[model samples]
Target: MKSGMPAPDGIQPARRATIREVADAAGVSRSTASRALTGRGYVAPPVRDRVREIARGLGYVPDATARHLRQQASQSIGVLVSDLSNPFYAGLAAGISQQARKRQYTMMLADDGGSPEVEVEAAEAFVALRVAGVIVTPVSAEVSTYLARQQIPVVEVDRQFSVGVCDAVVVDNENAARRVIHQLLDLGHRRIALVIDEMHWTTGRDRLAGYRGAFAAAGVPLDDSLVVTAGWDVDAARIEAHKLLSRAEPPTAIFAANNVLAEAVWRAAAELNMPIPERLSLVSFDDVSWMSLVRPGVTAVAQDPVALGEAAISQLFERIQSPHAPVRTVLLSATVAARGSTAPPPA
Candidate 1:
């Protein structure tokens, strides 16, 4: 029976053993028993064994609630992402879940639906849950300040966080973008255009830097008019492409920053009666499942979201185990997959 509760008439008078009971049975101080059970601080190996055996014999499961109350931390982890509908993010979430499962940890997943307010709300929810750690691919840099003030371990995935404020795992967006541009330049296309989302995010910004770097290296002057910014949606990109193509001088090659933008660019080219790899060349940042099935296979920079996700989860757990350790940054590599969509520009 509990300290102040009476056993019901039909219930047996079995009682849950407290930590003090385990300590008494093991012939050790309560503090020593706690150290032994938590594997924290210092406890002799023999004494730890005795405490474990006593705990087992007494059928005593250490009260996680009580431990959390004392430590002020929950063992749960929180994952916040921009869009669940994107295949890349979905794959990343799966990998994170798999890694967490292997480590005997649980995850709480939230999607911001590409909204800044939603992202803040998700972070606040994680704080309310008292999660041990947080993994996020933020919508913007504003989230850094919002989350950092919470005094929790946070790992930023696929994006850069504020300097010296949080750990991060990201791909080499600049190198990947440069590779795509070099591929187009190799195909004898001089007037190449780049379709991208906002440059506020690290991914977009680095990709733009890469694009400019490649052009500079190739002795091609940067063309501000050729770089078009659009939302991360096929329809939005298609509308933007229409405006670009209807201009007096259109591009001979287009490098779309992501899968959705690539699809829209392709659709616009088809509508304008522009033959891919003949009248125009096309390449994109990410390779989606349906990339190969399109009329002209999309040449793309492909990064393994699964591996990125797994690495992020691994890093987060490492931080959990050693909270005061040095901040680590992991950069995943990407490969340019050549396809039928790129060729020498029309003479």
Candidate 2:
């Protein structure tokens, strides 16, 4: 064949070269070529070099999927998150990807958009792909149970639904919420509104518990009407905020359970002409860029999402290495960023 030309045996340039071609060119058995290329069972240095040179010349590439199937384990790990658009999830995914690359493993990512059904589907897809393990911010316990039954190593991040069944990495949500709420109470805020999306998951449930705990600790009675379940939609949260602020006995302060609820509260306060920390105090569980950039920075409980992601991956690798080992749950602490948004309730 001419230089840079396709093989004369009808093999097109675009066609993937196979191990058989490499073996034939190297004048070796397929097993010998595979051992040399994969660094498996030993082959003579000279013979290995010769085989590699022939593979390079023929543009031969081994199929990782095929190799993984034969070995019954993949070098790829699956990561499933609720929402990629949220900065928290984005940062978490970046951390996971970085750690995965460092371990010479490929990452397969899936966005479930915060839907339990979608999360389950993604888990099934990961199984079909033969991923060596999974790291997920689970929406429901079903995903974890499914993966556990399949014998796939799983590490949960951000939230935990499968305690004792899989490893997990998360912030101390309940304590963080209690600390932020205590700050609001110390500012002489009597009537505080607790705004959250849902209590179905541990994140929201723990945060709500903290809010109530803070009130009880302060000898303050919580008004059931002040606790609003705004659901996951931002628009719904905004509407809920409007209703809360418009009440005859509107809260003097608002404790938003997450970043989304925080934004909704901010918007509602603006629409009602209630300037933050002036007419009404505000606090949030998660920190966002705008939280600090606004005229009066919003006080928040800042969780290290990236660190959480990295921890999840580290736990995943441990599970992969020792599948029968005891499951671990890592809890990272969240710090309170006391900004201008929180202060003594208006006189």
Candidate 3:
């Protein structure tokens, strides 16, 4: 391996082909080769095809970072989500990737695990990478505030923390939740319970408002005790749900605010040997896969997460195009997928 010594097998790692090499081989200037390969400028058809063929044969790949540096702009966007392990987030990310690619913008995706420190770190990294804009389901207002200070356009997805200060794309949480409760009320469920993790975010707060609103619309008083604050994990939620179901005057129906909570409730019901709809009615806000795989499909408020992602990218692109435009909040709709999970209370 000494310098210029005979190689063991006369083999060597192939060097990456550069634009200059391609230009020299194609008998053209570097700028013309660039224009021909990227189709960014005028080039005659024959010359363009010949240059492209030579570039391909040489396995030449353009340097995106250098191109962005030359233009003083990036053709990339940053996407930050709370949790990617969740199917909802995964679907949303997939949709965003598809839409961003369609517009020729590369997406740089990150998961913050709902941590403020991690989110701040990601924000700093995005700025360092020279991303054109950011789309995030922020853990707090700080992410948007920091990006705004950096003069980077941002769009919040799924939930909002900065309100009018940032663009957002979210579903009609209140109306969708209210409609879910209405269905329960119409079915004569009086002592209904709501199992939720926290009321801190716009998602939880709005859904709670809708839950209470439904009772108000029905002229029924809400029992505050029934609003159980469960923890984020499944075991914690299951314990809370078990306690609620074990009450002497247990509710006839339970409304789980999300899929994880719904899973906890379902597991608790199974442990208690309660036949769903026959004794305890279950409704979930998220329509996940397992909800339908069960014997009795869970009644759910279905949000099109893929469409949600598409909407977020669209909003982010708009923000990037018009940084001075008025901030906007686009609210998409959800539908009630009434399955076999809900029924009139026993007797």
Model 1, range 259-284, lDDT digits (tens) per residue?
78888988898899989878889998
Q: Quantify all predictions' global Cα lDDT against the true fold.
A: 0.86, 0.91, 0.93
Worst lDDT window (10 residues) for model 2?
A: 6-15
Off by over 4 Å in 1: 1-67
Top candidate when judged by lDDT against the true structure: 3
Better by lDDT, candidate 3 or 2: 3
Write one digit per residue (lDDT tens) for candidate 3, span 1-347. Answer: 57988776656435778999999999999999999999998999999999999999987889999989999899999999988988889889999999999999999989999899999899999999999999999889999999999999999989899999999999998999999999999999999999997898998999999999999999999999999999678899999999999999999999999998999999999999999989999999878888899979999999989999999999988888888889999999899998999999988
TM-score of each: 0.81, 0.94, 0.94
Residue 88 in candidate 3, Cα distance off native in Å? 1.0
Cα lDDT of model 2 by residue, 193-285, tens digit: 899888868898899999999999999888888888998777889999999999998899999988998999999889989888888999998
What local lDDT score does residue 156 receive in model 2, on the 0 to 100 scale? 88
Model 3 has an lDDT value of 0.93
Model 3 TM-score is: 0.94
